[model samples]
Target: MSNFDIRDLLDHAAAAEPAQPAPASADEKEPRLSPLAERMAALPVRPTYSPVIITGAARLADIAVVLATGYAALAIYIAPNHGYPLSYLGLLPVFALATVAALQAAGLYHIGAMRSVLTQAFRVLASWSVIFLLALAALFFTKTSEEYSRVWLLGWYVSGLAGLFLVRLALGLAVTRLTRAGRLDRRTVIVGGGEAAERLIEALAAQRDTGVRICGFFDDRSDDRSPNVLAGYPKLGTVDDLVTFARRTQVDLIIFTLPITAEARILQMLRKLWVLPTDIRLAAHMSQLRLRPRAYSYIGSVPVLDVFDKPIADWDLVLKWLFDKLVGTILLVLLSPLLLLTALAVKLDSPGPVLFRQKRYGFNNELIEVFKFRSMYVDQSDATAARLVTKGDPRVTRVGRIIRKTSLDELPQLFNVVLKGNLSLVGPRPHALHAKAENRLYDKVVDGYFARHKVKPGITGWAQINGWRGETDTEEKIQRRVEHDLFYIENWSVLFDLVILLKTPLALLKSENAY
Candidate 1:
């Protein structure tokens, strides 16, 4: 029988009591009645994982193995007959890329495929064989086959294949161990409860190897309409409670079990949830309507329609973090003299600390202390920025004015990027916790204002480079900044970051809105 059929029976038999009594208010210590659940059901839900870095590490390991295997084979052959030309080494990178590409195309990198050692070993062998044939063909077409040692070429092919197989086998074993311990599993939650949600839960349960643990379910309906327990899963609370739960628990994926035909309902739900930094999918397995083949992604055999994807996910997050550290560190060293001079200037010009630490909204709406070179007089400084900095403000010191206008005061935040791992070199600019525009909180001015915190705040951002930097005195200024920040998050790439970095200096030269 199917997994759902089995669960259906088990859940029905075990439905004697509610999973855990509905959460009670602080005044009442004991578990409360369904009234609490009903109250939460009326409230709005918010839309919201950690980036899966394991896959990125695996990819890097495979690439290293490929390179090492090629070089090892070449060395083995060269040791017998003096040395070969350095030109042969140039092919190592090309070979590595080709093998990885081939493996990816073969779906060997898919989580399901990586679960089995035998399956992965076969895929690795096939990918390496394809790379070898392509390399041989290229040599033949160029009529340069005889230039290199035939023994080395053949030996490298065999050694590379063996190396790839061994690597996959080891990884497969490690992943199995991690999965059993729940360390490698993705923490997922289901939205909507009832038959559709139960079906999705059952489908997920069948694929034990997929490593997705369904935490619970969230539905807008009261417990009477939507049972407190469905298919062995508890109804955590209503959609509103889901937002708080997701934030507190670090939820990775939020899967909506509602059908696609409920477009208005789905859209409304999305409006609430999109502000979160999590993968949101609409379960499409139970839908009678068919979509384009490319439109659906599978969680095991069950299909899900992609709604919104977390920005800079998985391997992309890894690459961005590495880029931030490497580039941020280099910039720190190169600008050390200027940093020291600025410190001295700030110290001499103002009778206060050189650095200013202000609490700003960071990734996932958490607060982080952001560092900056202090530019205002100690007595007159506005740590919370309750009052906006205006043109020729009396609070500014002599050196502070120069640094603030020239954007040199932001240099200390580079250390934030390199050290804290909270800031990226390129992302939305972090706003002070109580930062205001036009005498109003930013969240009041713009809907989904917190969405910008989905990614780590940056030292420099797309908005800043596009002339949205400096004082956000007007509501429109903050709104425009949020719009730009959203755009950058939606279309992030390593190349895009470099482009923004390149244009920042020119943008800072204008100082259009700086006081």
Candidate 2:
């Protein structure tokens, strides 16, 4: 693999034209910018909470089509003569599962497959044929072939094929439309502006169907060493500037072109880049050392080593969202009485709204309004938490002290989990954007503090259950809290979330740090 020719990575015929002279930097001169780039820049650099994975909407759509076709086939053959078969109803889910799995195995759902209408139709036919054959073989093996109607089976098979084809046709058109609208392309940036970066750019440009849009490059080198323009791409800024640029732009992937031999420099750059919620890849096309194929992920045949992947990507995101909504709704219903009573007590004890909304650093460092039952006098409310709520603070109302201590004040955030979908039931606890410790911001107290926000903020997190909750009067307190948050992100799992949730109530009972 190390000896793989670099020339094979690029399509010489389609290579990008020599880059034009470098335009003035955005900061140095008024440069004309694309409307999309301009809008992204003007937007506040908040943590974007978008599902980074391919929207499962398409997958779900395909599943629905499979299910619908199966039922339609059953109805077409059975309903006219003997009515719907009760046994067939149970078989629908199994068939749908099998069909989806087959399609997945055949790579029909891949982004590349969606680019061509003909290719999608062909794959659909092939996958559907496999499902039909499997179903027939199962029937034959079970000796149940004689029990079912041959006419019904034949009609169902024909109808299912047509249905699958039509669905793929519609999906192909939709993909085309979305791609044209710039909704389907991955926003990519190159990290080094040298020969390696140029080669990767040319490779990506040749495969336009790969859906990678190389916006620009970010390098620390000077123009004389690393030209301002590389293979029709300009250097946006330096390595540090890449962080700010990434925050401003909807950058999805950052490809590092620096050779792997520069381990110290690469590690230093990664320390800065990993904080942003984006995939970081080290280009390996020019590397001398070869590793197993499993070690590298490909971006259109060009091998790159994965440095850091955005956590809970693709289908995992969908699963987590479903978990949050299902549990959040159940919790809201089960605890409605306590929630109502808490609202009333807060209303009677304090002259403020039942719920208090405070701006907190949410997923990707975006400011989200986290809801909580009001626990302070209306006039003395510290929205920013500029003053940490100390024990026996006079500003805390009578009911506020009890709620804050017991964590009942946090109940309203269930709405944030179920309704707004911003906060998860388990993750790092969201802190007020201006939350401080000894007059220093939490980020200043800890390295990679912003990295914790890569996942959504939660009502109860690892930090709280680990006894790192409450006032961060000392720097160590905040440091420990961040430490726990990062650990939770790295070691996240559904079982882990359940464990945290189970431990949270007991932790609350202790309330050693609660104000």
Q: Scored by CA lDDT, what does every candidate get?
A: 0.79, 0.78
In terms of lDDT, model 1 sits at: 0.79
Q: At residue 267, what lDDT does model 2 achieve?
A: 93
- Give me the displacement of residue 75 in model 1, in angstroms: 3.7
Looking at model 1, which ten-residue stretch has the lowest summed lDDT? Answer: 1-10
Return the TM-score for candidate 1, rounded to 2 decimals: 0.82
Residue 209, candidate 2: C-alpha displacement in angstroms: 2.2
lDDT of candidate 2 over 1-515, digit per residue (tens): 01111132223313332222224575642233332333334544323223225435556666777678768877777778878777677667776787778778877776667668798788888887888788889999999878777776677667777877776777678766666666666678898877888888888878756667676677787756578567866555677766766655567889999999999999999988888888899999999999999998988888999998888777677788888999889999999999999999999886769999898888877778989999998899999888898988999999998999999999999999999999999999898867889998788888888999889989998999989887789999999998998898888888888899989999998886888
Provide TM-scores for the models. Answer: 0.82, 0.83
Prediction 2 TM-score vs. true: 0.83
Using lDDT, give the best candidate's number: 1
The superposed Cα distance between candidate 1 and the true structure at residue 71, in angstroms, equals 4.0
